[model samples]
Target chain A: MNPKVSHPRIKEFEVVTNPKIIKLLLDGTRKDIVFNYLVNEPMTVKQLSDAMKKKPGTVLHHVQKLKNAGIIQLVETRETPRGIVERYYRAVAREFRLGISERMSAYDDDTVASKDRVRAALLGLSTLGIHISESDFEHAHDLLQRLIDREAEVAKVYDSPSNHAFQSLPPSTRYDVSYRMSQFLLSQDALYRKTLSDWHDLISHYLRKIESEMV
Target chain B: MSWPSNYPDPEDNDRKPAETSAAAPSPSGILKDFKVGFTLAVKNFLSFGLAMLGIILITILLLLLIVLFILIPILFTLGLPFLIQLVETIATGFQTTTGLTLVMLIMFLVLPILGPFFVALGAIFGMARELVESDGTQAESAFSWYGKRGLSLLGGGAIHFLITLAPLVIAFLAISYPTWNPPSDEELRVIIPLIVVWIILVNGMLSLTYPGIIDGLSAVKAAGRSVRLACQFPVRVLGAWLIITVLVTIPLIPVINEVAFLWAPIIPSDLLEPYGALAILTLLFVIVPAVSIVLTRIYMILTAKVDATYTQGADST
Candidate 1:
C-alpha cells in the first residue's frame, strides 16, 4: 500500500524561508515528525507519541509548533468510541530545503559559533557513512577552522574601501561589487583554495585510514 | 510535485485555523522585545506611571494600617521596657535560639500578607499587556482588580512567593533540628550549586504564572501551564528572565548615582543635582515601564504555544 496516496496534500518539496521555522525544524523530534513519521503516513498525536516513545502531551506540543510554522497540517479528525475527537496530522511537504536567509548569511558569531559549525560538519559527515574518531575529528575540525579563518581574511580585504579598485564608484555600488568579489574569491581564489585543500586532505586521510582499519 | 491552490479543503470541520499572529518566543525575539517595550512605554508612560504610583501609595497605606493594628496590642500586652529588651536580645543575638525562632515566626506571619502586594506587581504586567495589544488601558484599570479577580492573582503571587521562600524555610527547619549539624566545606560545595539550580528552574517555571492568571486561568492551572511552556522553551524563558533582571538592576548601578559627583570636581556642583534628578526620572518613567512591557510580551509569546496545544489537548482528552 502506498502511504503517499492516502495523503495527496503533501508537497514534494518546500523551501523553508522563515528563520524561526528553520530553527524549529532543526530540533530532533520536530525534524523526525516532518521527515519520518508524517512523511510515511498521516498520524494522530497518540499514534505519533507511541511511535516516537514520547508522552502524548510532549508530542502534541511539537505538533502545535510544526503546525504553527505551516510545516504540518491537520488532514482530518476521527471520533473515538469514548466520544473523544482525535486530530490526524500530516507533513505539508515530504522534503524541505533549509535555505539560508540574508540575515542568516551575515554569520553572527553568537548564532553559528565555531564549535556549532564543527558539530554540524561532523553531523553532515556522518550521513555519508564516514565516522571519524573523536581525536581525529578534533584535528580535522582545527583544519576546517583554519580554512574558515583564511576565507574571513580574504573577505576582510575585499570589504576595505581603500583596497578596492572600484573606489571611484559610489559607496552602494562599491559595496555590491566588494560583496560579489569576496564571494567569488572565497570560492575560487588560490588564497582560500590552499586552506580548503589542506582541510580536505586532512579529513580524507582520516576517512581512508578509518576505512582501511574497518576492512 | 505541485500543490493545489486550494491546498486545504474548506469544508474540513477539524481543520485548525492558522494563527499567524501568535508568535512563539525565541532568543532572537528577545532583541526585538526592548524596542517594542520602549515604544509602548513612551506612548503610555504618564497613564501607566500614575497608575503604578497610585498602587504603591495605596499598598503602603494599607500595610501601615495593618502594622499599627498588630502593634498596638503588642505594645499593650508587653510593656515598653519588655519590648525594648526583646528588640535588644534579637538584634544583639543574645538569646540566639529564641531570637531565631521569633524571627522565623514573624516571617511566616508577614510573608502571606505580602503575597497580595507581590501579586499586585503582576497588575503592571496586565496593564502593559493591554497597552501592547492597543486595548487602551486607563489609570483606573490598576485599581479595578481589587475584587475576586484580584484574589486569583493573589493566589498566584502567594504560590510564587512560597516557591521562592521554600529553600529558606527548609534550611531554617533543617538547622533548627536538635540532631542537625552544620554542613562542612564539601557539603557546601554540593549544596550551593544545587540551590542555584533550584532558583533558576523555579524562576523560569513561575515566570509566566501571573500572566497566565491575567489571561483568565485559575492560579493552579496558570502555574501548570507556565511549567509546561518553560519546560518546552527553557532557553527562551531563561534568556528573557536574564534580560529582565539586567534591565531592573540598571537603576541600582552605583555609577549612575556616583558618576555625576565623580565628574563634579571638574564641572560645577550646580549641574550635579539636575543630572541626579534626570537619572531618577529616566529610571522611573522609562526603564521601569519598559521592563514591565517587555516581560508581558515575553510571557505572551511563551504562552501562545500553550493556547494552541492545551486547547487542542483538551478536545483529544
Candidate 2:
C-alpha cells in the first residue's frame, strides 16, 4: 500500500507485498517456518527461537536475512535480564496479495518470482482443499486470473484509511466479507455454469427490489 | 520477452463482448501471452528439447512397424490393383501419377485423423501433467504421463470435432438445400448472418476443453461451462483462445509443408529426406511439447487455490 493513503481507523497496516521479500521467505524451508511465526507478531530473536524451540543464534540469522530483504523491520528495543538491548522485529505487513506486474505476466514459464508465488499458494493447500483435473486446467487459469484482478481492486480502494468506503458505514450498510476456495472434477462444469447464472440473476433481482424499497 | 514495468492499459473496461465500446484486448492479450509462453519454454529448453527428440524417433519406429507389419501385407494381399499401378509407375520412372496420389491421400487423411490424437496424448496433456507435478525437466517425465490417462486426447479431440460439426451442419443445410424458387435478397442476407453466428457460437462452445480438463468433467459439462465463461468474460477467453490456437498451429507449418512435398517428390528423394525428417522431429519433440508446457503453466496459474489469510489465522492481530 502507498504510505500516502491514509488509514484513519486501522491500527495494523497492510502491504501490497514486495516480490523480493516473498522470494527471500520462500527460498528455503527454515526461512518459510520462521516467516510463518514472525508474521503472526512482532517478536525478538529469543522469543522466536523459544517459540520454535530453536537456538537464538540460529533464529538470529533468519531474522537478519528478512531484515536485509526489508520484509521484517525493527519496531522496538527491549532490555533483557542481562541488560542487553534486544530489537523486536515484525513483518512489514500482515497480509500479502500477489502484486500485479506486466513483467511478471510476460513469461510463459515460471520465473523465480512466479515460482515463489506458487510456493506461497501451496502453503494453504491442505486448508483450501484443492483438486484439479486435466480439462479444468484452462478454466482454473481463468478463475485464478479473475480472483487476482478482484483482489487488486479491493486493495486499491481500501488502500488508505481516509479513503476507505466502509469506514463510516452504518451497521445496516456494512456487508460481511467471506472468502472461499472451490474445486471440482471434470464432471461438474455444467452445474457450476448454471449455478453462476442463477446466482447472478438472484443477486440482481434482490438488488433491484431493494433499490425500489427505501432503506 | 520484456513487459513494460507498468501495466498501462488493463483494457478490461468495456471488455464484455456484449458491450460495443472498445475492441478490447483480445488480439493484443493473446499476442502478449506468446512472449510469456516463449520465455517460459526457453527456460527448460534443453531437457524439453531432448524429450521431443526421443518422442520423434519413437514415432518413426512405430510408423515403420505399422507399415511393414500391417499396411504392406494388407495392401499387397487385398489392394493388389492399386499396388500394381504404383509399382508400374515407379518402375517406369517417367510419369508421376499413382504413387503421388496415394501418398497425398495418406498425408491428407491420416494427418488430420490421427495427428490431433497423437498431440493430445503425447504433448499437450503430457506436458500438463509434468507441470503440475513439478518434476524438474527430466526429459522422460514429460512424456511419462502419456498412457496414464486413457484415451483422453482422443476423447477431447472428438468433443472439439463434434462441437465444430454443429454450425457446419447448419451451414451445410442452409447453402446446399435444393429449391425450385430462389429467395429474395433478404432471405439470402438472413441465411448468411445465421450461418456466421453459428460458426462463432460453436467455437465458443468448443473452448470447454481447458475448464473440462482441469475439472475432469465430462465433455457436456465442460461445453456448458465454457459457454457460460465466454458469456461472462468474452474478451479474456477470446484473447487466450486465439493466442493458444496460433501457438499450437505454428509448429505444424514446417511439418505440413514437408509432408505436402513428400508425396509430390519434386526434389530428389535422397536429398530431401534429411531435412523432412529433421522438421518432423523438431515439430513433434521441441515445438509441440513447449506449447504444451506453456498451456499447463497458464492453467496452473489460473486454477491454483490459496486459503484466505483470515482462515490461516494470519490476521488475528
* DockQ per candidate: 0.01, 0.01
Most lDDT-accurate candidate:
1
The digit string of per-residue lDDT tens for model 1 on A1-215 reads: 22322354668877776767866876779977877788767787777777888755456557867886788886654333322334567888777664444225433566566536754565356456565543365567677777767767886775665754667779899778877887787887775677677777866786787789889
Instruction: Candidate 2: give the TM-score of chain A.
Output: 0.41
Residue A87 of model 2, lDDT score? 45
Per-model chain A TM:
0.53, 0.41
Q: What is the C-alpha lDDT of each candidate?
A: 0.65, 0.47
Q: Which runs of model 1 end up more than 4 angstroms from their true locations?
A: A1-215, B1-25, B72-95, B98-103, B179-194, B253-284, B309-317
Write candidate 2's Cα lDDT for A79-140 as tens digits.
Answer: 22221224456766654443444223322355534643433333223133332221332344
Best by TM-score: 1
Q: Give the TM-scores of the predictions, in the order they appear.
A: 0.46, 0.36
Please give the lDDT score at residue A113 for candidate 1: 67
Worst 10 residues of 1 chain A by lDDT: A77-86
Deviating ranges (above 4 Å) for candidate 2: A1-215, B1-36, B58-112, B119-122, B132-135, B173-232, B245-287, B304-317
